[model samples]
Target: MNVSFLRRNRLLAGLFTAVLATGIVAGTAAPASAGNSHHKKIDYVALGDSYAAGQGGGRYLDECLHTKAAYPRAVDKLPGVKLIADATCSGATSLDVLKHQIPRVKHKLQKAELVTLTVGANDIASQEIRETCGAPGAAAPATFDEQRCTTLVLKAIANVKERVLKALVKIDDIRDRVKILVTGYPRLFAAPADAFQARANAAVDGLNAALHQAVKKANMWGVRAYFVDVTRAFHGRLIGDRFPWLHAEGNDTWHPNKWGHLAYSVVVIWHVKRIF
Candidate 1:
């Protein structure tokens, strides 16, 4: 069996089991009051980590790095849309969102028509992985040890799925009628510039795949969850690209820049129309 393929199957199976354990099933169409109607002002609450907080976009609103140029703010500008709260923070994990961010937005979410979540990257420690695996002159065994990397990536993906499910359950408890868009992270490089870059990009692919599966399971469990793929929106604009929308190499490397945030907003706005 292909090792990568097997890992993906395992990750998806874990997500299915997590959702099944919650005892929720994809049901009939949402109620008319599901908040997609145009007559009502949509209460939007943004949740999750740095990407959702708009860390790299600058113009910080607070320590959380919530920016006026962020996708949520762009979405907020839409007709009949009102941003009730932005509980996103730069270093938030899924557990952090569940513990700290959720409480802050629970009241607002109770009446929210739309909620956008961009999490799970921090849970899997993408930044840390890049730092370790892509560091200059890092030593590796003479013989490739694919199993070691596979094991670590699989475990990380599973943890992300578990935490994401838990967070989704909490959101469901608070607001069952809202449309939840769970966005995935984009590949940092359009093409691997080196061996370490290859490994790092592979890890990102695994993370995105896990997030996609989690969102799918959430929808299966009648949670009204949707995965928004920003990969295509980020095409040809990776870290090494000539006109990169993401930070190249620094403390902020891989985070989307202002143009990237605008692209994210476009993808989100397209999905928002479908939901509302």
Candidate 2:
């Protein structure tokens, strides 16, 4: 609650920063419990958008931009955690996960003990950010069209119920034993230097809010699903900062850089340890 106290604890400081920036979490901070609680290896299957695909980390293995530096790969490095499959791809939507990525896993999904999904922002929010702000090109946008951005963001939030939540239900419909850890996107900017940064950050907050609620709704349906909030993982090290973990240019623009993926991996592993 106090600066000196937070300064003494980096973890507390990080959560404090997340609260101020990302606003109220839709559910409890403790992720839903599932999986074998005993420390065990996971037969993991990674699915969803570019963030899940490791898009910005580095050289890609395919058109999907599935880089070796992806957070899932980092997690796979842990002892006994074998990567069953990573069907993540850039620009994938919730439906894309159900239609394409899921099928790629085949019977593996039933065998997999842990599945991680990061979707929905690409469904509508990011496009609105690009519209209200500016297309991510050489650098982060300096200006923002607040009125239009806000309008589009509102629609995107509403769309989340139908598009994002439904996808969760479908995934939940699959074998219930498989634990689904649905991760939320992080704020792309640190201090939010201008309208573009501020509004873009807000847009992600809206997306995450809807997503958090969606996961809660899934849990109420008796599904083994949980929300992994990584909103403050890049708290003070976001875009507009000297050492941003997100890409400022190239095809990976706005996607997490290698260091960013590492941070994501840490948040995920921490959550996994806390839950399991």
Candidate 3:
């Protein structure tokens, strides 16, 4: 009846159809990954922030903002992968992964053959994204009122470096040989719609650079770690695209919609198959 309700219903239906189709493919004919000797499933543990937690996708599984559409669940659907635990939460920072989420999943870490980390955004620029962006998706204000937001976000990233290392080391210590994939964030929009959008996109670039550095540092620490570039997840689908993968309403603004989650899942899955 109402516009919002109608749009909501349409989105939900689309998500349900997509997930169901994915399930069918997984259940009926998912192929084994190349490295697996006999289609042995890789035990995986996913950790990070809202991106990994599957926020703003379809439906919430818990307060952490996990949804069935998250990359971990999607990865699990592959014939050669099995999800052990998803110790991620919405709004989690790198330190939160180190001090809170990781501790709870120690045992899970022990058994995980693969672990993926998608954090650090919250630790650095979340405030600027939320307050400066004046949006729920943790982006710069719609009004672009904060000229200094980008600078602040860039400066804040330095703090997350050590925290990311700590989290990586902790995971490595727990699962000595487990392949660690620290994923980078995608640009929220395909192109810069304006100065604010351009700055916001640049902030994401800064975040990705920080993540890449953290991965390298983790390797120096003797951790079997790698950085995953996820920018391509939104290659042709951005805020102004005809088929944008991210939502644009209420608290979902700028967060990945189901299609965006699917794209993220594909990128992550590709890295897993190639690297792990």
Candidate 4:
């Protein structure tokens, strides 16, 4: 066997062992809300990007677009749930969460019982799909670069994976008293009206896949992170639908509408309840 190959195999084996060990630890560890009662207030924090910030929902709390209609606000209404802080913002990437968003909630995280996050889309430049493949009246790139688009998306996925790992690790550091729930993006369109829409949907799928995998890996490593999929929540309400939940065009193009935010809040609340 090649020495380098042997080293690679050894590394893989070590990682697998570590994952299994963490699984065992997680299985035996005390529940996040072990002694908590219904009467106790649950310190909750929300963090992420436009989706979490409610960019397209309507009235904005600030330039970040954090809105009164955002899911976090809805979550705050739940019994025993207290909104500690919502650090989400429009156009925030994973790195932004690491630097800016996390700091806003870092101290709160140490005492939080629940933390909800919906990041990573901005990390992959989701808007590029609209600018490149889906730009109206603009000629599509040559067939030779079709694969290039795919490669670019793949590279973004890899970068997102690393960033997610780092973010999860940081969250875990302050999550001894918390349960973290990370959300995945919804598919951009239910059915492609044209090649542009098709390509955009595919890109969304890739981004969501990367997020799902990252959450799974984090759980396996005992990071105590869970993925809450919202893809299906917008099943019939994708862009181009008569009553779409997402914006088809405008400054908030591709972002969810108010109805979409309501759906997201419902899904998140359901998951939070299930976890506790």
Candidate 5:
């Protein structure tokens, strides 16, 4: 062999050997990738009723029982998500979630890393209240019998409170490794400037107050459960702002519109990011 050609061939072999040795050393000394080894895989599950299901958000996934607009889908976008089940149905109350959703999980809850629940709206007939309050001539009642409305709302609140507590207990049993999130209701009515509107607003405030109290009692597990307050975020805008995620008045009034879903996603993401 020509001496110069022989030297060049040896140099090429040396470079190849060095490359193979570097890879072997790396494989033995360190992990395959910093992301692969240290990254924690999370199983995220969403529960509760319509708000969590994204009833009118205009897009949905058939298999997971989810709407694309709901916060779970948004959360799945985060890194290291291994599984997500957005099985919350449109009319589910707190009990429905605890009894129905928990049994349907094919994936084990033992590995759950996060959970988000938006419930209690369906514990009573909120739509009926609105219809009665806004009846053609119900406004300015001669006697102002708030009892009829208050009783209906209170009953609903009480039922939801009990169910929520029960659900939280089940959650604790399945996976204390999970971070639980409980969200308050979004403003369903426009803030009012008069007596009738004020009464309606007070009713809504009462419902949210009940939700807060329920979460407080149930979140004592040290699982980092927290409530997201979205009531004030849409205080004045819910009525006519063409909210992206709020359904139009006649279109399933209680369900969220696309924009409303986006807003929900933002609030959840804001809090969820903190834990990581």
Candidate 6:
């Protein structure tokens, strides 16, 4: 072997060893957080519905509707993360979070450095129209019945807004230092040109708009809350993305799949890094 070649190999080996040693030392010496004693370890309290729970996504834990790739689980993989991922069963509306999740969270919030919430879809009243009115061969609402569907749409939006506002109020009791991230829903229906489809999508958008408004109101009250808009994030990929996260009629398709969860994780982490 050429003498210079042998010397080059030795130099490369030494460099690799040095890098490995540095990584180990850094891992051991450094706390996961950036020197904030209060955030030495990330204590996350996750709240919300199926998306937060990682529904329909791949790699669910125990194959229960909740998947391992859910945003909370993804965040858990980050260095120094300690997560209390308590997103409940699917179909949980904002009211459920306030009446149930908030009470259960009081204990965790005492020490939590992060709190993330994803909700509002279940609060929408259009669930019945989507379930009952849109079925195959279901009688089209008579010209007279169109008003009924419209009525349901408006009622659901109003109720969802009310629930979202109440949840915002309850959020104030959580810890001050904890960064609260409120997430809006992704569009389940792709953008459509048909008049009826357009109207239906509008109802869904209304619910999401309410969610955004609620988060803003909470922020005004001095909660460290921010909203992650995922409405257009999945545009054009709904059908092409084999694992559609939208709940199919009757199945728990309303929740997110693994891919959908991953997308949400990206948005959440993007904002979360800003403060923490």
Q: Once superposed on the true structure, which residue ranges of model 1 sit more than 4 Å away at CA?
A: 1-40, 126-147
Candidate 3 similarity to native, TM-score: 0.79
lDDT of 2 by residue, 1-276 (tens): 657434534664364345323211213322323222233356778888889888888888999888887878765654445678888888887778767877777577777777888987786646545655564442344565567767776876777655666666665566566778889988887787776678778878888888888888888888678899987767766788766778877666788887777678777766655444
Deviation of model 1 at 144, angstroms? 9.8
TM-score of each: 0.79, 0.77, 0.79, 0.80, 0.73, 0.74
Report clash pairs, candidate 6. 55-256, 56-257, 57-257, 57-258, 60-67, 125-156, 246-253, 247-253, 247-254
- The CA lDDT of each predicted structure is 0.74, 0.71, 0.76, 0.74, 0.64, 0.64
lDDT of 4: 0.74
Q: The CA-based lDDT of model 6 is what?
A: 0.64
What's the lDDT for residue 78 in model 6?
A: 50
Task: Report the lDDT tens digits of candidate 3 across residue range 1-276.
Answer: 558645744664566455534432342333335234245457889999999999988889899989988989877765566788889899898878888889999999998888999998786556645576554344435466565665567666776777888888889899887889988887876767676677768778888898889889889889988888877656666787666778756776778888778777766776666664
Model 5 per-residue lDDT tens digits across residues 1-276: 558544643553454344323421243332334124236366688887778777677755663345777767766665444445766787777777878887676365666877888887766555665454453233444454567767776777787777777777677678865677888876655644565556655665776787777778876655456777887545444654433235545645656666566667666765665554
- Model 5: weakest 10-residue lDDT segment is 29-38
Better of 2 and 3 by lDDT: 3
Cα RMSD of all models vs. native, in order, equals 11.3, 7.8, 6.2, 13.7, 15.6, 9.9
Clash count for candidate 3 is: 4
Q: Write the per-residue lDDT of candidate 1 for residues 75-157, one digit (tens) a residue.
A: 77665567889888899987788788988879999998788988877765655443444344335445555665566667777
Query: Candidate 6 lDDT, tens digit per residue, 181-268?
Result: 8888766556554565566567667877877777677777776677778766566435323335454344554455545666677666
Task: Tell me how far candidate 1 lies from the true structure as C-alpha RMSD in angstroms.
Answer: 11.3
Q: Best-fitting candidate, measured by TM-score? A: 4
